[model samples]
Every structure is written in structure tokens, then in C-alpha cells.
Target: MDHDIDVFAKNYIYQKSILLTKTAQRADWDREDVVSELTLHLLRRRDQFNPGRGSWTTFVKAVVNNRTTDLHHQLSRQRATLSLSDPRVSRVAERLEDIERLRHHGVSIDPESDQCDRTIDLNNVLSQIPQRDRRLCDQLSRFRTADAAKHLNQCRSNIYRRIVSLRKEFSSAGLTDYWK
Candidate 1:
């Protein structure tokens, strides 16, 4: 597979195209378009493959599945054509867009329309972090990792260490879906 990426890709596409028919039907997308999207994704993310961890097929399969789901979301968003000009409808639409944007950023919100629960949950979970670590997360939101490290007077590795510990706590608290 070292020098035969194209050959491997062609073989994979031929084998997988049939399986993607369901994805096409569910997402209201074209089979050819889905195949093209997955092929491009594989090429772009090929360097992420780790031979020691798994085979190329496993990695490609995972990527293909993820890309297919993303395609579904993309198609759903595109097909949503609400022309609600009412004040309440506009507000609801704005909130829905905000929720979708947050989900895209890996912040899991409750599926229900009540965003208050999401806000409370997010605050409760974040409160578990130490003040210093919370500060690091805030800085991370506003800066690159290196810049955040500099601002915090810590090494880059320390920043990463804090992030890992923070995420572990988030996962332990059953907020894993919100860990980005």
C-alpha cells in the first residue's frame, strides 16, 4: 500500500460504493457524490494512519463512516428551508442554528429545545476543573496552544497535560460527548 495508494483507493471505492447506497437514500445525496466525498476525505486524512495501531482498511472504514455521517448533516442543513419571518419563529431558528453550531464544535447540547439545561450542565461540568485549568481552557478558546502556553507561563507540554487531565474529568463526569 506504500506506493499503491491510488490502487488501494480504487479497490476500496468499488467495494464500498454499493454499501453507501443507504447513506445516499437517508441523506438525500447522490451515490457518486458520496463516493467522491469519501475518496477526498481518505486522501486528505491518509497521513493520520498508524500502521502500528491498525490496518489501512480499518482506518479507511472509520473515516468513510464519519464522512458519510457528516455528509448527512450537510445535506440536512442544506435542505432545511424555513422561511419563517415571525418573531418567535426567527428566535427559534436562531437558537437551533446556535445549537447546531455548538454541536459542530463538539459541544453536546441536549436534543430537546430547552437550552437552559445544556447551559447548566456545561457550567456544572466545567466547575469541576481547577481554576487554573479552567483559565487554561479559556485561554485555549482564544489562542493557539503555543500562545496559550506563553500566556499561562507554562510549557506547551504542560498545557497539553492539563487539557488531557481536564478531558479525563469531563469523561468521568459523563460529559465525554462535550470533550473536544
Candidate 2:
């Protein structure tokens, strides 16, 4: 029993060492460090392995993927921190603010709209409404009264009534002139 356990441990380590090396290569990591860390983690979890349920390689792969993901996140945070204090970054930020101020004054240097592309044509006008009324506007915009009455078995009068209410809300919010 002792010899069998020893062989199993050795085989598990040997197979997973190769696998960790490959994973580290794909992630552009130092293979030696990744393999060393994976070996330590496997040793820590040795008692948890159940050969009947799954292969040792599967467990080691999961650990490697998780560790590499964590490392990537740590490196990303470090890069972000470094960039924040960089003088060039501050200069770029100041330039962006200048461009934004010019754009807001309607200088029209750039053709693209500053707002994100709208899904519905009525979004600009409907956005001024309270959240509860926004859903009604979305439904009205999505389904024409005639189509909704035919497919959804809804009444055209209900759709028209909602549209009239939304138009009143729009006019009260001074959004009607925004479209003009």
C-alpha cells in the first residue's frame, strides 16, 4: 500500500509538472515558477485527491488556471497604478478634457455623436421620464399599435393611450424641442 501510494504521488507530480509548464508557456509566464507553485499546491491538496472520481491532471489544471488568472489581475492592477502617476498620462487626460470642452460647445470638429448609439429612436426624449414611465415608452416604441394588437392580442386603444401620456410627459419635460 505504501509503495502504491508513493508511485501514485510521483506519477501525479510528473504528469502535472509537464501540464503546468505548458499552461505557463501559453500564458507567457516563467515555466519554472509556475511548475514550482503548482507542485506546492498539489502537495497541499494531496489528501483531497480522489482517484475514483477524477484524474489528478484535471485538478492540477484547475489550480493552474485559477492561479494564472489571479496573477494576470494583480499585474493589471500594478500597471494601472503605475500609469495613474505617469506625467504623460496626466497630459493625455488634460488634452481629453480640452477636446471635451470644445465638443460640448458644439465646435463640430468630430462627426461622431458623443452619446452612445441608441437602440430606440425615442430614447433621447424618453430618458427624461421617471423609471416607471420608461418601461411604457419602451413597449410603445418596440411594438406599433397595429402590430401589437394583431400579434400580442393587445388593444390598439391601450397603446394609443400610453403614447398620448408619454407625449404629454415629453412636452412637460421640455424634450420635444430637443428633437426639433
Candidate 3:
């Protein structure tokens, strides 16, 4: 039997070994060292790898999961050194308290409000355009810019220009004048 492995096998083994090692060592140890060791181990056992047994992907996934579990247990033992008195935890709590206080003061923060207003303004502005421009704008807004360009068969720059034009129209129509 020829001892030389195919390029696909070599690449598959190398990538899987690295992922396995990283998943294993990320919790407590340096991921690089683990990857190096795993690389060497895979290279050494390359001859033993059989295509009939299972896929290289499955084998690598299993190895990664096993290594990750081992590292988790190892790190869990070491984590006892850390105490709850860490200042970062207190800072996070303080920030949460501030948010709660704002809520209590009848001041609500809605993250989607800006997006909703933009969407409403865009719809209103689109209605004023001819049917073709209105349809194009609606399609463009469905995707931000890049996605809209691809979907609408327009260049990214063209999509941006259209959006700008729509915005100007909305402004002129007093749709956003209420914000002033």
C-alpha cells in the first residue's frame, strides 16, 4: 500500500485537528499550543485514517468535542481561584440598575423606534413617486443597500443614490419635519 496520503485527506485532517485543539484549550490554556500538538498527532496517525470508517469531518468533530470537554473540566477546577468580589461584576450590576431607574422614571427606550420612523417615512415618500420608482424603492428598502443592489439588478452606488433621493423627497414632503 502506498504510504502517501491525498491532499484532501491531509487538509481535512489538519483543519479538523486545529479546530479540535482550539475547542479543547480555549477555556484554560493557549489555543495555539493545543493546535500545534494536535497537528503533530494527526500527522503521525495519518496512515491509520480510513475512509471506510466514517467521514473526516465527523471524526474531527468528535475529537474537538472530547478535547473541549476535557479542557472544561480542567478549567472548572482552576476557576475556584476567582472570587465574586471582582469589580467588573459590580460595574455591570450598576449599569443594569441605571437602566431600571430610567424605566421607573417613565422614560422608555425603544431600540426599534428610529428604524420604524424611517420605514414609515420611506413608505410615505414612496407613495408620492410613480409606480415604477415606488416599486423600486420598496424593493431596495427591503434590503439595505448591497442586498438591494443584487436583488434589484442595480449597482450599489445606484441603490445609494436612489435611497438618498427618496430621503430628500421625504424631507420635502414634511414627513420628517415633525422631528424638528
Candidate 4:
């Protein structure tokens, strides 16, 4: 009769160090949010708790573990979805670093390599984008968002929207994983 949900929620967050888990951190969840979700899930599954199979604590703990993982996965997906449409900081240095690493490794830069193949595919996808948007895309490639906005005689917000649309295009082309 002592199935106190509040106690388990607090202990899970603190003594169990659920919040300290790397996945939880990456999910960017606050204590209240996690607890709220945990409570909701536990309440909904109360009827499924089998006292005959195991004790209340055991059932609750298993539920907590599973729900924690599920919440992290859901939140991570939401974060990725949001960022995919957001104009992020330019990653020009990262592209340069890839070239530097290949040179440092003394690897022959072949056009048929996986990276080159991805690049070719990406170019093909870029060409498929509307002709009217090519100038904006070109400006974005060579400059920062603000600078690109200036070059195009448009506001920064306008540039941000264009970048978001470009990301959507890239996403539809199945080139998202390639860039990552």
C-alpha cells in the first residue's frame, strides 16, 4: 500500500543520479520536466503493475529506467528537428579540418572516395534547387549568415529563413547524414 510515487521521483533524480546521465544532459531536460513525465507515465501504467510478479518498488524502478530512455530519445529527436530548421553557426572550419586530417594521414585524395561521392551527390541535389534561390545559396556558402544577408541586400531574418528552407531541401534530398 506504500506506492509513494513522489519518493521514487526525488530519489531517481538525486541519489540515482538520473539527471547526471549524459543522455539526460544531452536531452536538455529539467528536473521538473523529467519528474512530470515520469509521474504521468507511471500513473497511466498503474493498472499494469503486477504485484504478483514482483514488488512495487521493482516494478516502479523498471518503469523508471525504461521511461527515462524513452524520454531522452523523444527529446533528442525534437532537438534535432528544431536545429535542422534553425540557422546554426557556420561550420566552415569543420570542412577545412576534414581536408587537413586527410592530408595529415597521407591518404590519397581520390575523387571516388566516399567523401567525394557524397560531395558529388550533394552538388546534384543543390543543382535541383530552384534557380531563383541559387544566388542566396551561393552567398550563404561563402559568408556568415549576417554577411550573406548584407550581400543579398536582405535582412538577417530573411537570410535565416532562406537557410532554414535550404536545410529542408537538403533534408529531403537525403543528404543530411552525409553532411553530418
Best by TM-score: 4
- In model 2, pairs of residues that clash are none
Clashes of 2: 0
Q: How much lDDT does candidate 1 score?
A: 0.71
Arranged by TM-score, best first:
4, 1, 3, 2
Candidate 3 lDDT over residue span 1-180, tens digit each: 223444654565456546654544433355566555555554565555567887665555454445545545665555433235666677666545655555677656453575444444454566568786676666754656687678778788876777677667777966654323
Alpha-carbon lDDT, every model: 0.71, 0.54, 0.57, 0.66
Misplaced by over 4 Å in model 1 are 1-115
Per-residue error at 27 for model 4, in Å?
A: 7.4
Which of candidates 3 and 4 reaches a greater TM-score?
Answer: 4
**C-alpha lDDT of candidate 3 relative to the true structure:** 0.57
Compared with the true structure, what per-residue lDDT tens digits does model 1 show for residues 1-180? 342356666677655665666544443445676677788888888888888999887787787778766766666556433446546688776666766767778877776645544554556666776789789878987998899999999999888888888888777766666656
Model 4 agreement with the true structure over 1-180: per-residue lDDT tens digits? 445566765576443335534455542456666667777777777678778899877887787778877876776666442233233423444444555566677755565577755654566676688875788778766887789888889999877787778788888877777323
**Candidate with best lDDT:** 1
**Candidates in order: C-alpha RMSD to true structure:** 21.2, 14.6, 16.6, 16.0
Give the CA lDDT, 0 to 100, for residue 109 in model 4. 53
Which residue pairs of candidate 4 clash? none
TM-score of each: 0.35, 0.28, 0.28, 0.38
Q: After superposition, how far is residue 70 of candidate 2 from its true place, in Å?
A: 2.0
Poorest stretch of ten by lDDT in candidate 2: 114-123
The count of backbone overlaps in candidate 3 is 0
